[model samples]
Target: MKKLLTASAFLTATSLLGMVGNAQAATISALTGYSTMGGASTGMQVRVTFADNTTSTGVWSAVDFYSGAASADGWTLFQSGDTFGNPWTFSNNSSKTISSLFINAIAGSTLFDRTNPNPGTTGSAAGWDFTPVSGSSPTSFTYSNIVNLVGQPAVGDLYAALTINWDSGFSTGSNLSFIADTDSAISVIDPSNPQPVPVPAAFIGIGLAGAFLAKKEISRRQKSHKA
Candidate 1:
């Protein structure tokens, strides 16, 4: 709900994540983080972190995303301190079903409305409903309360809990989400960036020192021969 992210001044790319293994302690990672004025966005509106396996030691883990900010980036984009609901779509196999769904937000009972991804035929979900998403096979869910058929739900302090049995362990995989403009794309976060995330400048300095010493050794050898 606070401390949003902004592109320092750049653009990069990666591949969509593939299905994860059913291995215990399978890691759940944020493949890609973006703010799409017209696409699926992933990440937490509030400060979020991970909890140990929801099942047991080394099993399905809980990505506990919670916090109640009076006001957050419910909507809007591009610029300093921007905000949005930030709906997320983790790596899904299209076969595995989310075992459990939990949502407990104190909305502060404030009137709120947000049509982030879309108004999507005004629907509603009780915080306790495990199938808040509806249907067995689901790729995504647009959480909202239909006050007006094409309006955003009025509420804050959003909460949700989901359990998924990834076919494989959480590793490199593909991700998919919607976007508004053609400029948007379906990309993934390559933690294993083929082009390594650059090293520190201090490391570069050390490398330069090594090269200088090597060059000095050769120069001294030439001078010794003349002597």
Candidate 2:
């Protein structure tokens, strides 16, 4: 009975120690430098970095352009071209025209468009509209809740998409530009519990003292029974 009691106490302490060892880690970052260049591009390159310090590069062609106009009616007017490197360029011919431009996540289906009158038109003279396909356009641009990549981004991850549109015979002098942006790194916690240090020498001494008292009590009871 004494041995069983000691074993039980030891097991309880061990279990608690194990729990202290295990805890979860989380992290996040933003994709930057995704933009459109106005007019025909000789070449372009866009870089994207993940929360884990992983990176991927994208090359764009001429036909791929983004546009912002009075309405969707003007969307069909842009001409498409081939991709060369990172910069998506449009045909330099006088007939080709680009109205607006912006960048979108390659895996993301949502499109953000910026086209409104009044106070909305203030700041960033760049007519480039940021639109999300599903809902209304946002009043400002902000990044949050970034995706968790299983592993570091691969070459074909499609970090972002460059969209461009042009109207025939409308040389409005519209183009897209790529800007470099950086995201803050996130801290991740380990999910596994940390190993607990063995009971200190002092703690062990206390435990032994308790056990001695318990043994003494048992012996005293046994003696009384014999009496």
Candidate 3:
């Protein structure tokens, strides 16, 4: 049986800075964890390591990783641990434009294939190639394949679901607010669950709706039992 889990993310920033209108860059950091993976027999992999010391893994595991800060409206900078699992250091001049998005590891980073079981490193174009999807517009861009190559044969047919869902134009939004939205993101207990429902106030309606539905269901059950 699959072990479903839950995750929550919090943004520790009050307001985003000049990451939008100008070329100023900022770093948004977060300590992740408080998630669980599926059973061990399913070739599950670890996705998130939380501050509470609990971890989550799964088949193409759903990890509830978080960003520590908020982002601005325009464009921002974000870097994840590369394929080789090295520590990230923010440089003085390390800023990438929208056109700089690539599949291979960022400069000074190594390439890795998450889908591979015994994955070997390769170039971004060769290993994890990324291309703009067919229906991309000035405001929204979608790429069906975040990673081109699969590391493990078991997950060859499936691909990862990564998204940079911002509410403004990619070319015109602020960088700090963009990362702040990412900071308030969330992950699911199962792959089948709705994704990216963050822990910030942005998603309070979702929580309230879920609670109301659950309460309604409980009241209905009680009335049925009374009969």
Best by lDDT: 2
Between candidates 1 and 2, the lDDT winner: 2
Cα lDDT, model 2, residue 62: 41
TM-score of 3: 0.20
lDDT of each: 0.20, 0.23, 0.21
RMSD of each: 23.2, 30.7, 18.5
Cα error, residue 137 of model 1, in Å, equals: 11
Q: Model 1 over residues 62-130: C-alpha lDDT tens digits?
A: 222221111111211111111122222333232222221211111111111222223121222111111
Q: State, as a TM-score between 0 and 1, how close model 2 is to the true structure.
A: 0.19
Q: How many residue pairs clash in model 1?
A: 28
lDDT of 2 at 44: 28
Q: Per-residue CA lDDT of candidate 2, range 89-191, in tens?
A: 2222223233322233221221111211211211111112221211111122222122222353222112122322222222433333211111111221111
> What lDDT does candidate 2 reach at residue 105?
26
